[model samples]
Target chain A: MDFFIQQIIQGIAMGSLYGLIAIGYVLIYNAWGVLNFAQGDMVMIGAFAILVTHIFWGLPIIPAFVVAIIICAIVGYFVELTSFRPLINSSNTRRLIATIGVGIFLRNLVRVIFGADPYPFPSIFGNTPVKIGELTIIPQNIWNTVIGFVLVFLLTVFLNNTRLGKSMRATAQDREAARLMGINVKQSMSLTFIIASVLGGFAGMLISPVYFVIPTLGTSLGNKGFSSALLGGITSNPGSMIGGITLGILEATSTNFSTSIQASVAYIVLFIVLIFLPNGLLGKKESRKV
Target chain B: MTLFNKVYKATRIWILLAVALTLPYWVPNNYYLQIFCLGMIFAILTLSLNILSGMTGLFSVGFIAFFGIGAYTSAILTTKLGFPVPLAMFLAGVLSSILSLTLSLPTMRLKGMYFAVATLAFGEIMYQLFLNWTAVTEGTKGIKGIPALELFGTSFRSYSKFYYVILVILILIIMLARNLISSRTGRAMLSIRENDIAAEAVGVNVPQYKMISFLISTFFAGIAGALYAHMVRYVSPESFVNAESAAVLAMMVVGGIGSIPGAIVGGIGLTVLPEFMRFLGNIRMVLYGASIVLIVIFAPRGLGGLIERIDNILSGKQSLGVQKKQQHIEGEE
Candidate 1:
């Protein structure tokens, strides 16, 4: 029982990191109606950006985090303008292939620049274990949970209340209608990409300390984020979060209990989720609009 | 579907087969010969995967099931039963395809992406079993000392000999694939990809089309797997993982999904490109990732589309580009 509790906590931490990355995927799909295969890698780029800024550039965590995310966001904005916007206007297959190409390029570039070796990044939260009865949780885990929830909460507040966020929502709901309403639809779409990228950037900073920072990090997490995006069913933001953490639990449990193959739990969970509930737990059923 | 069309197809295949059979002598290096052989192996797998994903649009993230099954079946048969190489491999391909087909039939009723998910799930389960079932597969260590293909009195040795055998297999497989895709069966698949319900409503027999796609894809997949087992003389579960499957799918897409020639180009281009990227050293993956993003964003049509565009320009014809009218006219189907 205690072990299960610990596993769940561990799962939540991992799930939150995934949820953070998944947010970028969900955000892209919500606005663009396309899966950004490169989102996880973008998160990877974000996390690496943080590591380079802090460890390599010798900047402190607070400022590095901000700068790294901003940099990542700019990179994402460029990716959107160059790749996605064109695809959004082009054929469906064109967009799919393009996103996949972007994902491949990004992952390979990381390998080229950083080497394939996993880099160690210091934890943003100090190395301390929090004790609660028989269960001991890593402070990083708690921080991840707190910050992830907080980030989404803040995002919700922003999307609901702020002018820019409202513009994004309107654009997401209906591009033509939003454009008719005098909202700059194209700019809003770009901003959505920027916001998602910024969120991914923050996620990378948050999780870098715990997970080994590597170029392949995005490849693994991208698959996980797909599950998260689907989990919230394609339309729900909070559901994406739930999907992330829940999948994390499934992964943690599978790792802890299932036989060898520490890495494939996500694939199994992904297949299971996809096979059983293609609609996802919270996702609205779109089904290619029949 | 015409007699003349059939004759033309056969002639073209024979020419390609003859080329594959005779081409290896031009290559000078033994190591390059080996790489050539491996390239053929990947091409076979890519062709197999193309039947499913490229033609039918049944996108699966896990195809390693048949690949691994072929390896395990061959390994178990040869190592335990002391079976002849030909018998073991033949049985491996057949059995692997059967296993893949049997598992796919019921689940295939679920259309589109759902089929992709189910196949992926099944693949994961098979990988887990291979890893966990230590008694047979030796767990993570995988099956080793797989006997080389011995036909008649001679053992397949030197990269050239192996290359010929693999090329023959790839040619035959490609022939089968070209035939299958160009036939009525192929039309049904493209229809399904375009719209599943519409195809069914138009009397396309959606279930049969899906099953046939899965069967043909896995048949080639099984052959490729057996080829890999024999070629590498070793098998590990990792070789058949989802990532490998994804890579194969990526090849199909990058090469030109649904285009047979595209699969070959994509697989070879990607595999060969990565080997060269080693010079970039540590920065290679970063470059690899960034470029994939850019490529997908820019070239949605993949390599096949690129070729078509170039062809149009070279032929002095103004291409319609993405306009639907020109696509239907240009597409062989």
Candidate 2:
């Protein structure tokens, strides 16, 4: 029972990290109707940014995290400006491929700058497992869950109450309609990218202590995060959260049975979900008027 | 005028055949010959992918899975079962087509990014299977010492010999693609790409046409894979990954999605460009990514469109406005 409970905690912690990244996917999809294939790389860049600030520059942990996220947001802005913006009127295939190009470029650029070696990320939470009634938990895991929930709550609030956030929602529903309503659709899209990038950075910083900072870290995680978004319905924020956590739990539990195929479990699940539940767990059926 | 056009077309084909046949003479050495061979192999693969993505408007990032299946099937057959190289190659293609048909049954319903992701998953699953199925795949140490192609008692062991073999295969495949694109089935595929609902309303069996397009593409991909395995005399999981699939997709896009001549140009250009850019070391990938983004932004029609534009200019035919109108209609659709 204790072992199962421990697995659940671990799964939740991991799920929260995935949820953070999935939020990025959801945010971008909602705002621009474009899936950013480079979202994972954005997360990777964020972790590297924190690593450089905290470790190399000897900055305080909290400030470094903040700075790192800001840098990621800037990167996201440029990504939209340079690649996504120019190809806004192009086909989805072209847009998707361009994002992939940006991903490839960013990943290779990091590889050139930092080399391929994995760097040990400095743990913001002190290195000690807290014990509670036969349940031993890492402090960082608790922090991860807390941070994830906090961000989700804040994002929900912002989207619901904030003017910029409302504009973003409007843009997502219909770009032409949003423009006619006197909303700055372009500005809202850029803001969405910035916010999504920041969330991706936060996820990276949160998970780096557990997974180590590596140039290739984003590839698999990005894939899994996308799967989570799909699992929850790409358009729903809360659904993404549930999807990420569920996938994380599934991954954790499956590892107990077979370690060899663990890497493929998420993808297999994604394939099944895509085929059987295209609308996802919480997604509405989208109708096309042809 | 009709007679002149016919004669000109015939003359061009003859000249192309002559050039292809005598390529080895002007080629400097084995290194360049091997590059040409690699380029031709990629050309075949890109063309196969084009049949689905370019013509049928299905986006698949997992054609490498079919390529890998072909490579492994041929490698195991020739090396383990002692089958002749030619028989193994044919069986490999057949198997790949069958597998693709099976995959299409479940995945053909998906559109756009959903389809891309599903295919991507399929490729990853195949890669993992190749890596973990140690007994058959030998588990990443890779299958080695596979024999090269032998025909009429002459072994194609040298680069020049392999070059001719690949060139002949490429020519045949190109002809096959050209013929298919002009056929009834080809028209159905183009219709599906233009609008699946409209095609279905017009009495086209959408699913069957999709399956056929996928089957044919995978068949050719399998042939290319088998050729690759035999030429390299090895098979490994590392060579057939998402990166490889992406590279092939890049080639297809760079060449011009549905154009056969574009596939050839894109395949050869991308394959050879990397070799030439080897001097830039790690930065080459950055350049590669940048170029892809730039190409998509500025010239989404790719090199094939450029070629058409040049042809129009040479003939003093100003049909640019008409072409733009056609593109606008397609885009609106």
Candidate 3:
């Protein structure tokens, strides 16, 4: 029972990280109908930004994070201006491939600057464990869970109640209809990118302490987040969150069996989910108008 | 086709064939021959991928996994089972085509992006299998000392000899691809790419064509993989990573999607050009990524489009506007 509880806690922590990245994915995908494959790279860049500020410049952790997120937003804007805006009228495949280029460029640029070694990330929660009776918990894991839920709740509310969020959703639903409704579709789309980048940056910051800072940090994590978003149904926020947690938990539990099982759990589960629940666990059935 | 066109085409083919056959002599060393072999191998890969991605419009990011499957299959057969290389390569392609069914069938109902992600999942799973299935794959240590090419009492143990084998295979595959693309089945596949629903409504059997496309593409990918395995005399999970898959896609795009000549040009150009840029050191990949973006933005039709324009000019025809208008109509479809 104790081991199971430990696994659950670990899963929740990791799932939250995946969830944050998924939210970014869902946002950009919704706004532009293009899966920004670079979203993962953005997360990696965000973490690197924090590394520069907090470690190199020796800024306080809070200021470092804030500055890093702003840098991420700026990067996101340029990403939109360059890779996306030029190809707006092109096919989705073209746009997606362009994003892939952006991802590779950013990753290599970071490698050029930082070299290809993993750096130790300083943990914000410090190296301490909280004890309760016979059970022990890492302070970082607990904070991660709490912060993850809070952000998800806040985002759900924001998307549900805010005007900008509503406009973003409108653009996602039907770009033409959204334009007809007098929405600044272009501006809305850029804002969607910035917000998504912020989320990606935040995910990066959150996971850095746990995963370390590396040039190739985003590849596997991005893949996991992508799978999470798909498993939850790319169209739904809550679904993405649930999907991440489920995937994380699955990975944690599977670790006991074999390393191979742990590594493959997310993909195998994603494959099964995609096959059986094409609409996703929380996604609506798509209606086509001929 | 006109008599002039026929004469021009025949002359071009003969000249290209003559150049290809005599390449090893004028080349400086075995190193250049090896690189040419590698380029031809990748050309085979890009061409096969084009059958699905370029012509059929299936955006499989996991296509390289099939290549890996073919390589490992051939390696195991030749090394462990003591089978000949040709027989092993054939079986490798057959196995990959069959395995492609497992992926294509379940994801048949998925839309473009979803299908892509599903294939991505399929790729990661395959990578894991290659990494962990140590019994067959030999794990991360990789399989080494595979047998070389020997057929009909001729030994292709040398690089120049091997080059002929690859060139012959590549030309045969290209001919097969060209013939297939100009056929009724190819037309049906193109229609599906333009719009699957519309094609289905018109009785094109969308799922069947998609399956056929997958089978055909993966079959060749497997063959290319077998070729690569034999060429290198080694097999490792590292050779078939997702990045390599992306590189092949870049080749298809750089040459021009949906163009046979484009795939060949893109494949060879991407492979050969990178070797020349070894002086750039670490920044090579960064430039590579940037080039893909620039090409997508500025040269959407890629080198294939440029080649067509050149061809038209040489043939005393004006086709620039006609080409653009055709593409526009196709986009509408």
Candidate 4:
């Protein structure tokens, strides 16, 4: 029973990380209808930024985290300007491919700069286990979950209450309509990318201590994040959060039974969900007007 | 329409074929020959992918999964089961086609991005299976020392000999693809690409045609993989990573999404481009990513389309129908 509780707690922590990453995916996807395949790479870049500032340059943890988020946000802006903006009128496949190209570029660039070695990340939260009855939870895990939920709450409030967020939503709903309504559609798109990148960077910084910082870290995690987003509802923030948590719990439970299939669990779940429910768990059924 | 034009068109194919047939002789250096051989192998894979993605308009990013399956099947068959090379290669294609059928049947209902994601998941799943099923795949250690391809008691132990074998196979595959593209089934595929609803309205069995296109494409990919396995005499999970699939997709995009000649040119150009970029070392991948982004943004029509346009302009034969066809292709995207 203790082991089960521990696994669930671990799952929630990991799922929160996934949720944070998935929110990034949701933001970009909701705005531009382009799945940013580089979302995971953004996370990797964030972790590396923290590594440079805190570990290498000897900055404090909080300052390093803020710098990392800013760095990633800048990268997100550039990604939109260079890759997304130019191909605005292009096909979805082309846009997706461009993002993929950016991912490859970012990953290779990191490898060239940092070399191909994994680095141990300095944990922001000290390595202490908090015990509740027979259950033991790592401080990092608690921090991860708390931060994840808080961000989700803040984002939800922003989207529902803020003018910029409403404008972004308007653009997502209908670009032409939003443009006619005097909304800066392009600016909204850029803002969405920036926001997504910051979230991705935050998720990276939060999880780095557990997964370590590696060049190719984002490839699989990004895919899983993508899966989580798709599973919840690509366009729904709450859906993605729920989806990530569900997947994390399932993954944890599955790991208990067999370790060999751990690598493929997310993909397998994605395949099953896509086959059975193409719109995802929380996605609305879209009607096509021929 | 003119006699001179007719004669020029008729002779052009022969001229191209002669040059291709005698390429190995002209480039007798084993190192360059090896590069050309690798290019031809990729050409087969790209061409096959073009059948589904370019011609049929099913953009699958997981074709590498089929390639990997084919390579592994042939390797396991020949090395473990002691089967003949030819038999193993043939069975490899068959098995890959079967796998493609199973995967596509369930997921073909998905449109566009959903379909791509499903296929990507399938590819990742297959890769995991390859990595984790250590008892069969030997885990990360990879399977090595597979025997070379043998035909008529003549082993293609040398790169030059292997070059001819791959060349012959490529030629046959090209001919098959060309024939199919010009056939009624090809028209059906084009219609599906343009609009599957319209195709269905016209009594085309959309799902069935998609299945057939997918099957044919995977069959060719499997053959390319088998050839690759025998040519390299090794099999490993590393060679079939998702990045490989992306690379192949990059080839198709740069070549010209819907153009056959484009696929050939793109595959060969990309295959050889990396070798030339060796001086750049790790920067090559960065450049590769930049090139893909730049190409997609600037020349969405691709290198092949650009060449075709230039040719039409230079020959003073820019026809309205050709322009209309190009527009239609772009519109389908």
Candidate 5:
């Protein structure tokens, strides 16, 4: 029973990380009806930014984190201006391909700079064991779980209460309408990318200690996060978070069967969800404009 | 058309065919020939994807799944069951198309990003099977030492011989693609691409055309996969990774989506470009990445589109119906 509890805790931690990445997908997806394929690379870039700032420059963890977010914000802005802006008037397929191109560029650029080897990320939270009754838990796992949920909560609050968030939401709902309403539609789109990129960077940094900071890390992690978003109502904020948590728990339980099952759990779940709940668990039915 | 124009068209086609046939004679080394073979294989992939995505507007992100299916099918058939290469290759295509039927049925209802994600899930599931199904796949060790192409006691052991085989297959695929694209079914598929709702209103069966495009695309991809397996004498999950699908999509896009010649040029150019810039080493991919962005931005229609523009100028025609339709696709919000 303790083992299962412990596994659930770990799963929640990992799932929360997936939640962060999924939120990033949802944000950009809401802004423009396109998935930012490069969002995963943003996570990788964020982790590397911290690696360079904290490890190489010898800065404290907090400062390093802040610097990484800032760097990612800049990256987000630049990516939008360069890859997406020029193709704004084109089809969604072209925009999607452009993001893919950016992803490949960023991933390979990291490979060129960092080499193809995995790098160990120093633990942000100390490796202390916490005991709750008969259960022993890693401090980082607890921190990850707590911080992840908090971020999700904070993001929800921000979206509901803040003017910027409302404006961003308005833009997502209808760009033409938002523009007509005198909202800075372009600014809102750029901010959406920025926020989404920051979330990706946060997820990357969060997972770096657990998983190796490797160039190829983005693809698998990104795929899982994308699945999480899909599993949760893709357009809903809390829905995706719940989806991420469910996926994490599912993964944790499946690990008991075999590694193969665990490895494919996300994809299997994705297939099932797509077939049964095309609008997703919490997503509203999409209305098409003829 | 004038007699002079007809003669010019025939001569131009014959000259291009002659060049393709006599490639080995003009090429410098076997290494270059090997590159050409790989280029042709990818061209088939690009063309197949182009049919589904460029023409049908399906936009699959997990196309390599079908390719891997075809490859594993051929590998298992030939090595384990003692099947002949030609028969195994044909069966590979048949098997992949059959498998696609299962997927296409469920996924046909999905549109845009939803469909892309479903295909991605399909790919990941396929990849997992390739890796975890150790009883047959050898669990990442991959299938190896497959027999080379042999037909009627004539062994195609040499690269040049293999080149001819691939060339013949490629030419047939191209011809078939040309015919299909110009057919009534092809026109129906194009109508769906332009506007599915509109196409449906016009009495075209959107779902049926989408399925036809998907099946045909998977069939060709499977055939290409079988060709790749025999050419390299190996099959591995690594070759069919999502990045490979992206690369092939890149080729199709760079070549000119929905254009047969575009798919061929994109496949061959992208494949050969990296090899030609061997000195750039790690930076080659970075440059490749930049080029995709640049090309899409500057030359939105891709290199194939550029060729059409040049051809129009030389022929003194403003633009053809095909080009006009392409503009409509781009111009549609």
Candidate 6:
């Protein structure tokens, strides 16, 4: 029972990270229907950014965080401007292939820059086990879980109350309709990528404190992002948040309790979700009249 | 391009097959001979994937799973059960094809990127099972000493002999692919790929044709996997990693997705590029990956497609349908 509870709390903490990453996927997916295979690589870039700013340059933690987020957003915006925007006006197939190209290019490019070493980031939370109710988890894990929920809460308010957020949502619903409504479709798309990339970068930075920072750092969370996106049902913000935590915790529990070969768990979870809930947990159900 | 069209059109295929079938005996060095032979098998694997990713419009991330299936099946049947290599290879192909059908039934219902993800999961499951089922698959240690495809009662223990056996298989596969892709079935698959809803509206059996293409492609993968096992004389979990799948997909993309020539040329080009890069020391990998970027961005149609365009210009023939479609595909964006 003690082990199970510990596993559950840790799982929630990890799942919350997945939820954060999944938001990046959901945001771009909503604005533009491409899966942005580079989403993972973007997270990788984020980790690298944090690595360069703090680990390499010996910058303070808070400034490094800001720099990482800004750099990540800028890279995301550049990727959209260079690769995605041109392909957007083309076929979805072309867009997909192009994005995959970006993914391959970015991963390999990072490989060149970072030299494939998994480095340790300085933890903002001191190295200690945080305990609550007979459940002891990594202090960083607890921090991640708490901060993830708080971010989501703020994000929801931003989406509902902010003019830019509503414009982004409007663009997501229908590009043509949004254009008719005087929303700049191109700017909205760019904003979506920027916002998503920044969020993904933030997740990477947060994860780096407790995680292995490497070129393939994002590779581990790649499919989980997709899984959470599916979990969120792709149409709702709350759906994405709930889905991310759910997937992360489920995977953590499975890893802690089930077979130790947990490498298979994420793919397994994805396969099961794809099979059972094709539209995802919070996905809006659709009916056909044809 | 008239050159490609004339070449792809019976006359060219016959000459190509004749040369490929006869080249193994002509090569003097055993290692170089073996490399060409291995290339033949890899070509078949690429061609098999091409049938689906290239012709049918379905991108299979787990394309190599069927190949792994074939390898394991053949390895087990020949080594453990003491069956003949020929029978093992045949049955391996059959089993892999059947497995493809099974996977397709449940997963093919998913569309676009969903299909890609589902196939990836399928590949992972297959890998895990292959690793864990120690009773059958021998765990991570893997089954070794898989017998070679011997013919005329002669075991192909030597590179020279194995060369001929693989050469023959590659030729046979290429011919079969050419004939199959030119048929009505191929047309239906391409139609489905361009737009499934439109194809379905026109009475194309979207699911059935896709399943068939996927199955047939896996059949080829299985055959190649069995050959690869025997060619290396070993079967291990490491041989069938997601990296191998990515390499195969990379070949298909670089060679030109959906084009037969693209698949073949891409296979050979990529297979040879790394070998040539090996001389560049460790920096070879960085340069090699850079080459992939250069090709996709500049000549997205791959080497085969590029060669076809040049051939068109030099010979005064219209671009082949494949080239036009690839151009159309890129142009649509």
Give the Å error, residue A275, model 6.
2.2
Q: DockQ winner among the candidates?
A: 4
**Leading candidate by lDDT:** 4
Model 6 chain A is weakest, by summed lDDT over 10 consecutive residues, at A86-95
Displacement of residue B123 (Cα, Å) in model 3 is: 0.9
For all candidates, state DockQ relative to the true structure.
0.43, 0.64, 0.62, 0.70, 0.68, 0.35
Per-model clash counts, in order, read: 44, 0, 0, 0, 0, 4
Give the least accurate 10-residue stretch of model 4 chain B, judged by summed lDDT: B324-333
lDDT of every predicted structure (CA atoms): 0.76, 0.87, 0.87, 0.88, 0.87, 0.78
Chain B TM for prediction 2: 0.93
Error of 2 at B280 (Å): 1.0
Q: Ten residues in a row with the worst lDDT in model 2 chain A? A: A281-290
Winner of 1 and 3 under lDDT? 3
Clashing pairs in 2: none
Q: Per-residue lDDT for A1-290 in model 5, tens only?
A: 88998889989989999999999999999888889899889989888888888898899999988998899899889998999888887778778878889999999999999999999988889988988899999989999889888999999888889999899999999999999999999988998889999999999998989888989888998998989999997998888888898899999989888867897999899988988899888888988766
Between the candidate structures 3 and 6, which one is better when assessed by lDDT?
3
Error of 6 at B43 (Å): 2.6
- For each candidate, C-alpha RMSD in Å? 4.4, 2.2, 2.1, 2.3, 2.3, 3.6
lDDT of 3 at A59: 94
How well does candidate 5 match the true structure in TM-score terms? 0.96
Summarize candidate 2's per-residue lDDT along A1-290 as a digit string, tens digits: 89988999999999988988998998887776677889999999989999998999998988987788788989999998999899888777777778888888999999999998999986789988999999999999899999999999999999999998899888989999999999998899899989999999889988889898998889888988988998998889999999999999988888889887888888898889889888788888877544
Query: For candidate 3 chain B, which ten residues in a row score worst on lDDT?
Result: B324-333
**Candidate 4 stretches greater than 4 Å from native:** B1-10, B313-328, B331-333
> Clashes in candidate 6: how many?
4
* lDDT, candidate 4, at B39: 90
